[model samples]
Structures are given as structure tokens and as C-alpha cells.
Target: MTTEKLFKVNGVELWAETFGDAADPAVLLIHGASASMLWWETAFCAKLAARGRYVIRYDQRDTGRSTTYPVGEPPYAMSDLAADAIGLLDALGVERAHVVAQSMSGGTGLHLGVDHASRVASLTFVSTTTGDDELPPPSDDFPRFSTPDFGDSAAVEEYVVRAIEAESAGVFDEAAARVLVRSDIARATNFEASLTNHYAMKFDGPQGGGFGELTMPVLVVHGSRDPVFPLAHGQALRDAVPGGKLVVIEGAGHGIPEPLWEPFLAALVEQTDAR
Candidate 1:
């Protein structure tokens, strides 16, 4: 069974859901830019839980059911998002956990490993960048997608489906995509806050030498065809963290598709169990 609740951290209420036994080892999953915990997918969480892990997924401050500051730019820095992750762990009474972070949230994971190393058992960065100066930017061949009209539910759903299909072209599931989009629309209280979160990542400058401080095991997963961050991003992340392992999925893209779930779960389980 899964338990869903709101956790207050640093005066912000973050919406979270957990699966499996509380006594089991914990795995905290952090979603990407402008995404909520819904992005983690129910099946994936259940599978991870089945591996005897206490899986936890949560919405960031400006997204989903979490508290939002919609009137202006988010009042917190990227470090604050890192603190929120630790705060959630504290609230759940989990002294340490393996972190599975996606896209921009990888920044948060890096921060956790640096600023709060004692709380993280391991780090898994998925389709994300290290914000290092030496890495190449996104591919020029990558298409620029227009923003969707959030006020129109159909438009939002269609937009989400298109985006997911584009990112996970080989493994897109229409039914699952619809469900995730619907859930996000139903619970989104502040659209502007979500945009602000995107801006925070957009302007956040280079992060130098932080990854070198992580003493725990690190796993970097990226798709071979990912146009956003590209494979080089993952390679740079692995290079930055000492003894980090990289798992590149052939013919895959930015999103974790259905086809890669088994391999991804296996990698995650391995990292979590290693501790």
C-alpha cells in the first residue's frame, strides 16, 4: 500500500507519497523541472518498493500539491530545494536514503551530496546535467517545444503527451501519459510558481567542485539519444564524482521510457543495496 501526505519543511508544505514498509531502506525520488511526484509513475514506484525499499516521491515547493509562491519569482535558491530534500528526510525520520533525481533535480541531489553528505546513502542522476563549465550545451538538433495553454485541460493533456512522446519517442505510453497529465492539472495550484522553478534552473550558474565532495556511491544514467542534456552531460557528471558509474541506454532519449524501467530499477536497486 502507498501512503500520501503533506510534509512541512523549512516552512514549505511538500506533498509526498510513500510505498512499502517503513522499516525498509529508503529511496527518495526527485522529479525534474516543472514536474511533480506524478512524474515518477505508480508502476515504477511499486517496482522499487517490491525490491524491499521504502520508496518516497514528492512534489517540489512550486509544483503539484506543495506550497507555491505564484505572485513573483520563487523566493528560494537552488540550495533551498536541496534543503527541502533533507527536510523531507528529517520529517520522515529517515537519517539517510538513496536519492534518485531526474533532470534539474539532479542539481538538488548534487547539493545534498555536498552540503548534507551524511544524509545521503547514494546518488543516482538521471538524464541531467552537472552545470559544469566545461561540458557542451544541448544539441542544436533538439527541437524547441512551445508552452501549452494551462487553462485548457485538453490542451494541457495534449501538450504533455506530445512532450513525453518526443522525449521518450520509442517507449511512449498514451494511457499512462494521459493519467499523469490529468493528475498534474487537477492538483496544480500555482502555474507561475512552476515557471519560476524553471527560471531558477535556467539562471543558476556553474556548479564547480561540489560533485567531488560526495563520498557515497554515485550512478549516472542517461540516454544515448538524449538531445536535452545529451550523453556528454552524464559523462561529465560521472567524471566529476570519483568512482561514479555511468549507464547509457542505447536509442533512448531524455525521459525514462517503459523499455528502460527494468534496467533503471536494477541499477537503482544495486546502488541502494550496496550501502
Candidate 2:
């Protein structure tokens, strides 16, 4: 069963959903840029929950039902975003959790492992980079698509489909993508603010310095065909983090398509079980 609720952390209201028994080991899923907890998908969450793990997925501040900032660069730093995750754990009385973070939010997971090590049982990074400037840049073919105006529903739908297709290498369900995009449009209060704030992590510089010090078990999963971050980023992350394991999904792109779900969940469960 899944339960949705709001958590007040650092004076901000974060919307989150919980799955499985509270007594089980916890796993916190952090979505990437311009996405909500919805990005984790119901089937994926349910699968993890069925594995006897407590699953928690939430919208970061300024997205979904969480607190929204005004349109502009956000005032908070990357560390503040990391603190929000810890704050959520505190609210739920969870001392430690296996952290599963995707794309840009992967930085947040690294921060937690470094700054608040005791709160994290393990770490899983997907389709993410170390934020180091020295790493190879994204593929030349990466889509630099622009976000359409929020009021234009048709344009937004097309944009969402294109974005997903670009990330998943045209391996996504069109109907599900449309439903998610429409729901996101309706739920978002300030789409621009959320997007801007989410991407602001780029300005914070590379967060790879402390990876070698994280003692927790770590898993790095990447798509062989990811145009956004690419496979090199995953390789670098696995190399940097001590005892980190890397899994490459052949023919997959940046987005976690249906084919990768089972393997990914097995890896997650294995890592969490190690804790």
C-alpha cells in the first residue's frame, strides 16, 4: 500500500509518498531535473516495496506539491537541497535509508553520503555525472530542447513526449507519457521556478571530492546509449566512489525504460540488503 502526505522541513512543505511497511528497511528515491516523485513510476515503486523494503519518493522543493519559489534563480544552494532529504528522514523517524537518486539529483545523494553519512545506508546513482568539469561532455546529439510555455497544453505535451523519447531512445509508452505530462502541468504551481531551481545545481560546481570517503555500498547504473550524461559519466562515478559497482544497460538511454526495471530493482534490493 502507498500513502501520500506532506512533510514540513526547514519551513518548506515537501510532498511525499510511502510504500510498504514502515518497519522494513527504507529506500528514498530522488527524481532528477524538472521531474517529480512521479518519475519513479508506480510499478517500479510497487516492485521495490514488494521486495520487503520501505519506499519513500518525494518531490523536491519547487516541484509538484512541494513549496514553490518565485520565477528566477533559487536562493538556496545545493547543500540546502541535500538537507531537505535528511529533513524528510527526520520527519519520518528513519535513522538511515538506502538512497536512490537519478540524473542531477545524484549530486544530492552524494552530498548526503558525505555530509550526513550516518543517515545513509547505501547509494545508487542512475544516468548521473560527478559534476566534475574534467569529465567528457554530453554527446553532441543530445537534445537541447526548450521548455514550451506552460499555458500551451499541446506544445507542452509535444515537448514532454520529445524529451522522454530523446532520453529513452524512443522506447517510452506514449499514452503514459501524455498522462504524466498533463498531470504534471496541472499540479505544478510555477513550472519555470521549479525548472530553474532544479538546474541551478550546475552553478555549484563538481561534487566529486568526497566520493572515495563514502563507506556505504554504492551502485552506479547507466545506459549505454544515454545522450545526456553518457556511459563515461557512470564509469567515472564508479571509479571515484570506493567499492562502487557499475551496471550498463545495453541499448538503453538516459531514461529508465521498462527493460531496465527488473535489473535495476534487483540491484537496489541487493544494495539495500547489504546494509
Candidate 3:
């Protein structure tokens, strides 16, 4: 069964969707930056739930069909985003839930693990960066595409074409690339502050309060081909947390839903069982 609901946190009405049985153990999946809960990948989430887990995916304030921050409002930090997780749990009446977060959203799980250990059953960080500082500089190959300097139609069109070609050569899927780039561009245009808020991981703080405090069984999953975040970030997370398991999915890139979906499900299942 599935249901869509709305709940408020910090004056923002967040949208959430729930899947599977309520009687089953709950697994909360948080998507990466600039992405909606759809980033969780429907197939993966559905298959996991079919294995007898209650899964929840939601918009993180400004993404997808969620509430928007008002103009002139102060920026939201990783901690504030963490609070939204807590609010979701409370609204759902889930005392403790396993957390599966990717990219920037990994910090949300970490924050909850640090501040409210009792509320979290386990954590899975995927395509995650350890710290913004330790990250290897952006891949040199992605020069014009990575830059935010695409100032016009011609530059933007060329940038999108290049990105698609890079994603897969010989196919040149301009239609697919246009859809993705357009969605991203629309998000940035509609909610500039929220986009800025999503990128503001600097608030993750020094050492991020240390993973030593997370007593729950933790899983760190990363892909070697992931460009946005370096593999070293996964290693750092594993090193910091006691008994943390790291799963390196081969050939998977920044997006976990595609090439890495199976391993992602397996790692999540193992971590949930351990927790």
C-alpha cells in the first residue's frame, strides 16, 4: 500500500510518500542535493519494500512538491535539514527508523545519529563525501559542463549536449539530457535560495561531531565512477565509525539508482538486519 501526506516543519509543509506495510521495520530514504525523493529510484524502493520493509521517501523542503522557503529568509543548514527528518519520524510515529541517504543528504542522517541516537536504527551513506575539504578537486575532464557560468541559450544547449555525450557516447541522447538539465535548471530558477541551501554543506562543521558516537550499525556505499564525490569519502566514513561496513559498487556513477541499485538494496538489507 502507498499513501501521500503533508506535514509541517519549521513553517514549511513538507510532502512525503510511504510504501509497504506499517507493521514492518521502517527505512527512510533521503535523496541527494537538488533532487526530489524520486532520486531514490522507484524500482529499488519498491523491491526493498517487497522484501518486507516499510519505506518512506520525501521532498526535503524545497524539492519536488514540498513547501518553499520565503524570500529574505535566513539560509537553512544541515542541522535544520536534520530537524525535518526528526519531524517526519514524529509525524509518522516511527520511534526509530533506518536511514539511507546519498550525497549531501548523508549529513542529515549523520546529524540525527549524533544528536538523537535513540531515534535512528541505522545509517547508510552512499555516494557521500566525508568532508568538503578532503574531496579531490572536480574531475578536470568536466570543465565547461561543471561550471555555473553557462550564461545563455547557446552555451546552455552546448553544455547539455556535452553532458549527454559524456554520460554515454555514440547514443547522444539529447532528449533525455534535455529533460534532466531542464529539471535542474527549473529548480535553480524557481528556488534559488533553496538551491543555495542545498549546496551549503559547509555547515556540516569540523569533523561533523565524529561518527564514533553512532552506536547503530552503519553502512557506507560508494561507486568508484562517482564524480561528484570521491571514493575516499566513503573510506573516511568507514574509518570513523566502529563496525561500519563499506560496499563499493563497481562502475556505478553519482546516481545510485541506475548501475548500483542491486548492491544498494543488499547493503541496506544487511545494515537493517545488523541494526
- Candidate maximizing TM-score: 2
* Segments of candidate 1 deviating more than 4 angstroms: 201-209
Per-model lDDT: 0.84, 0.85, 0.72
Best by lDDT: 2
Instruction: Please give the ranking of all candidate structures by lDDT, highest first, separated by commas.
Output: 2, 1, 3
Candidate 3 wrong stretches, greater than 4 Å: 70-74, 132-135, 144-194, 200-208
Q: Over the stretch 1-275, how does candidate 1's per-residue lDDT look in tens digits?
A: 79999998999999999999888889999989889888898889999999999999999988988988754567787778888899999999999999988998888888888778888899999999877787787777655677776677688678767777777746667888888787887888876466456565433422434787788999999999887787899999899889999998877889688777888888888889836
Tens digit per residue, CA lDDT, model 2, 1-275: 89999999988999999999989999999988879888888889999999999999998987888988876666776778898999999999999999998998887888888888899899999999886788888778877888788677788778877888778865678888888877887788776666667766434522545788788889999988888887889999999988889988877899688767877787778888936
Ranking by TM-score: 2, 1, 3
Cα deviation of 141, candidate 1, in Å: 3.5
Q: Which pairs clash (backbone N, Cα, C closer than 3 Å) in model 2?
A: none
**Winner of 1 and 3 under TM-score:** 1
- RMSD in order of candidates: 2.2, 1.9, 3.9
Candidate 2 lowest-lDDT run of ten? 200-209
Mind giving the per-residue lDDT tens digits that candidate 3 earns over 175-212? 65566556655544334444444665446542336677
Q: Can you give the lDDT of residue 144 in candidate 1?
A: 69
Clashing pairs in 3: none
